[model samples]
Target: MPAALADGVVTRIPTSRKVVALTFDGGAGSQGAASILSTLRSQGVPASFFVTGEFATANPALVRQMAAVGPVGNHTWDHPHLTSLSDTAVRTELSRAESAVRAATGRTPRPFFRFPFGEYSTRTLALVHASGYGAVGWTTDSLGWKGTSGGQSVDSVVARVLAGRTPGQVVLMHVGANPDDGTTLDAAALPRVIAGYRAAGYGFTTLDALR
Candidate 1:
């Protein structure tokens, strides 16, 4: 299959197989990391993780644990909007994040990266590629990071993900809590989402497949 690239970023896995890629972004507090990991393990599912340099540095053990199970991608140094920074700054962000993840897991986060906040530009894309990484974007955003106060619930999160069900679908979730409410809606809704997808006859995959 030809890899799907939208503006030089992978928005889906680009396969004809009935599979979905589950991915989590780690930029802040990892209130949901443990639950997400446990659920994935219990279900024997493969998922991807994108972590900021700060997050990786602060949660080395958890990062290593994630790396043990699935591929870990870079999410930049301070979760900055790459388009807002110069080429040099963008490269630095990628380098710093890569260094942090390597230090934590003894593995390079090469060939896989996700834009912080999903923000990027044409120039930024070239910068990312030159830095030896491919940017990944989601086909379906769970929106669980919005929390209850933001009018998102566990059930809603499940529904949203299932609503976008498709072959090679990439589902976006966050491993951190909603800053305003401290709710981990994605983690809370994960088991049901997995079950729902299984019932719908979809298998799980990780970004590593892109390699």
Candidate 2:
């Protein structure tokens, strides 16, 4: 793991195959979760989710459903910026999230984590590794979390995902809606995005490639 962590953070799946890893981050809310799950199941697509401790604790049923389909990674306890916390605090966040996931679904979120707001520093990276987790970033963000109010629509989300298409690409999306506009663009764009990818002759994958 240290040899892999030597690179600091992973933004793309470490492969040259024509497959992309779809990932969702959950923190503030679970507005789009059910729809996202339904779309993935209906399309037979696989995706990973990185959720906070608070989210798992609050939404145990959703966590179970997520764990049933794909791997769930830790996104920290409160989704705090790891770079802003001390070493012990950072560790506590990771451990707390891991515990919350286990408590909710009786499954472990070992060795996989993502920084809140994609924020981290060299020291924070080392701290994450030391806490027994790998930091997974993304090849591109769908930006659907920004919602229509932020000038993002379902079409833009699909476009951003297709624009980042490549071998082992990691697409980042959020399971929550925009706090301001309350739009779940990711869920709305998911079916179309999956169709577009299949039409482009690309396959879907989870972050398990890195494991």
- Top-TM-score structure, candidate number: 2
Give the clashing residue pairs of candidate 2, or none: none
Q: List the residue pairs that clash in candidate 1.
A: none
Candidate 2 achieves a global lDDT of 0.90
After superposition on all CA atoms, what RMSD does each candidate show versus the true structure? Answer: 1.8, 1.2
Task: Name the 10 consecutive residues with the lowest summed lDDT in model 1.
Answer: 1-10
Q: Kindly list the per-residue Cα lDDT of model 2 for residues 67-158, writing each as its tens digit.
A: 87788999999988778788999989999999999998898887789999999998988888887888999999999999999999999999
Count clashing pairs, candidate 1: 0
TM-score of each: 0.96, 0.97
